[model samples]
Target: MKLSDRQEKIIDLVRVGQPVTSVALADKLGVTRAALRADLAILTMIGTLDARPKVGYVYSDKPKRNLLLDYISDIKVSEIMSKPAVISESTMVYDAIVYLFLNDVGTVFVENNGNLVGAASRKDFLKISIGGTDIHKVPVGIIMTRMPNIICGRADDSAYEIASKIIEHEIDSIPIVETLKVDGDKEQYKIIGKVSKTNITKLFVKMGKSK
Candidate 1:
């Protein structure tokens, strides 16, 4: 969910060690405590605000700015990335279907031996299911598009780079594949997170404020 100007102010206020009580938030936002509570609920649901007893909401620890933002704004992949939706290559199509529906996300990354191997979109699963294929019998690997050609991202990559890739490739999300070095050997790729269009949109909102 996109945050509003008031919501951003609330987050900033909370970050600066200000009281985030609904009454305080309401006063700052020029809204009723009831309205501020509603706003806080949304932020809490999206993992932005911490729920407390009477102390009210608190912002999650703010991320530190880097050299990238010296040229750009306060936008980073951490601020924009979505909770990863990863599955093993051996995952059943039925499982993928359930995850997609439950998470309301359209794509899932496929892992093999703890490394990224492929990705499957909702369209891939839908096409197979619609073609009368038994989901329980279909491994996601059968329909997944493999890596090497797949687009990916690094965790520390700037939001601008992520956004550019999303626009350039016309993809819904980008997997954040971390490199694993075993026994001091060469780095191998493994997906650890994911960033999506929705995430980029949030970054845009945050950057708009910093400007």
Candidate 2:
């Protein structure tokens, strides 16, 4: 990785000073410690610098491009996924809509016999609600996007995988599911959680707040 002029300067400073603190570096650069944080984090992440408790920063002499695992890619779906709002496929569309609002989620997963069967979005509920059809009478299953059509991910999946699928599928949420073997050894999906736009945003916000 090509070092920025500031990064090169940081290296020079650390090499000469040995164990310099962020406060001292900020003073020398005529910038606040906050301004130096990103640079220092990058430098530390790429093994260009080492941070010690109380002792401060030191030159590590590591290759700048030793970038192996990026932080975002290292985050798994299980870490960021939220509890899914699930409803029985037999549930009335109006009841399903109520559950969606109660959970404050964009999409609701539908399950039958403990196995995920389908999914319905807020738009689906809204469309059915406004149509001539009586939402109170219609089963959510009738309007649901059936399983195998609804995109899903596993707990072990990377957050990046979920994000890419969300963009490509143009869906607001993706259910996190697991395989269930039923009678005759038939495979089924068991809905456990969901990853939504809000979940992603919360993860990023939490990451930003972290050291």
Candidate 3:
């Protein structure tokens, strides 16, 4: 959400001149009109400036909300989440890695009896691969980071919160889960979908294209 110095300057010029044309702003800033296009578009997208037909750029007195953040915070996980790649916990690491490649995913969720139990990443597979362990005999269940320890998200969770968890946990993806049954202190969850780094990046890219 940090604006560059040039972007700050562009805001200042538009504010002082009020309804300044892109051509005038570019001239004052000693840049071409094309160079100002991106900045102007970003300002307008962020609610910092308003563009009027037949007019020019004028500062928007409305609340300056970071539109990207606004979109993320308001967006639900189910809106952007992709179908998660899943494998049985008993699947061999070698087979799991192959499945991971076939599905084009960085992480794979491991389930037992249709309940989410664990997750494993490419890094984990690679680590085991080079360790001289017989991957064919090494089940994903043993290598996978088990549930209650793995971070998870709900269908109703905000995309922003899930994205933050991805950063905070230093993981590639989060499994979106639904509570199934409670066994005393233990709870079972069914994997529904997942939100990954690629999803968040695409969301940002789409939001950035806003007018």
Candidate number with greatest lDDT? 3
**Which candidate should be chosen as best, given TM-score against the real structure?**
2
Model 2, which residues run further than 4 Å from truth? 1-69
Per-candidate TM-scores read 0.61, 0.69, 0.69
lDDT tens digits, residue span 1-211, model 2: 6879998999899999979999999999999999999999989988989999899899987664456336677899999999999899889998999899998989999999899999999988888888899888999999999978999999999987898899999999999999988887999999889999888888878877947
Pairs that collide, model 3: none
Candidate 1 vs candidate 2: which has greater lDDT? 2
Order of all candidates by lDDT, from best down to worst?
3, 2, 1
Q: In candidate 3, where is summed lDDT lowest over 10 consecutive residues?
A: 62-71
Candidate 3 colliding pairs, count: 0
